[model samples]
Target: MTTAVISDSSSLIMVGKLKRLDLLANLFQQIVIPHRVATEIQAKEDGVASLILAHPLVSIAATTRHELLALLDGTLGHGEAEAIALADEHQMILLVDEKKARKAAKNMGLKIIGLLGVLLLNHRRTHITGQDAILMLEQVKAMGFRVSARLESDFMTRLHNPITHWHSPNTLK
Candidate 1:
C-alpha cells in the first residue's frame, strides 16, 4: 500500500529552491497541502508556490478539523496545525520541518517524515544517487534548515556506506 503524505510549507520551499520539487511528486503518488500551507509558501515567495498551485500531483486540501486546529494552537503554526489535522483525518503521513511541529505530530500519534526522510527515501528507491542526496543535504544546511548534529552524522554515514538509516521523528532533534 502506498503511504499517504500531507506536506507543510518548509519542505516544499526547500525542495523548490533546488528546483526539484518534482521529486516529491515522483516519490509520493500524491501530496496534499492545506490551504494555509499554500498561503504560507506564497507569503514567503517560495519558488514552490507555482508548483503547489499548478502541479497535477499536488492537491490543495481544506482542513475540516477546526477543533483540532484550535487544540494545537500556539504549539504549531496554522499551516502545521492544519497539515497535522488533515493527516489525522485521512490517516496520512505528515511532512513537516519545524522541530516543534514534528514533536506535536508525534505526540498526536501521527506518522511523520521531514525533508531528510524524503531524501533518504529517494536515495533508497534509487531515484537519486547518494551524491545527489548529499549535495541536497548540504544545500538544506546552507539554507539555514536546522538539521541536528546526529542526523548530519547519520546522513554522512549513509552516504558513505550506502546503508539505510531510519529516522524516528523523536530522534530528529
Candidate 2:
C-alpha cells in the first residue's frame, strides 16, 4: 500500500465493471490519475466513477510536463497523454492497458503494467489462487475486455507455474 501508481482509464473501467476495483486498493497505496482519466471514468455513468472518486487512495493529479504532454496529445487520448506525462514527471510506475500507450510509456522509460499484470500480481501475492485467477480472466473476457488467445494461454501457463520461472512467457511486455 506504500507504492503509488499512475493509471489511465482503460484498466480502471474494465476492472471496475467487474466489481473488482478493490483489487487496485489492495495492490497500491495510492492510485494517482490525471483529471482527464477521471473525467472518462465518470462518463461511464456506472457506480464505478463514484466509488473510485470516493476511495481514500484515489487522487486526481495534474501533469506538469507540458512539452511532453503536448507531443503525446497529438496521438494519444487526453487521459493517456496526461498519465504518461505524470508518470514521466514523477518517475512512477504506470498501470495502463492499451498497447500503443504501453509502448509509448515504455519508450519514455516509464515502468508500465497492464490489467492482466494486475491479476498476475494478485495471484503472486496469494490474494487469489491460480484457479481464481483463471476464473477472473474468464470473467474479464466475458466482460468484453479483449484478450488474444495466445495471451490468455500464456497467462494460464504463468498462473499454473508461477514459481517455476518468473516472467517466462513475457505477456506483460
> Which of the numbered candidates is closest to the native, going by highest lDDT?
2
Model 1: weakest 10-residue lDDT segment is 164-173
lDDT of 2 by residue, 72-158 (tens): 999999999999999999988899888788779878778887887788888887888888778878887887788888877777787
Model 1 lDDT tens row, 58-134:
78898788899899876788899999999888888889989888888888888887888788777777789888998
Candidate 1 wrongly placed segments (more than 4 Å): 1-3, 161-163, 167-173
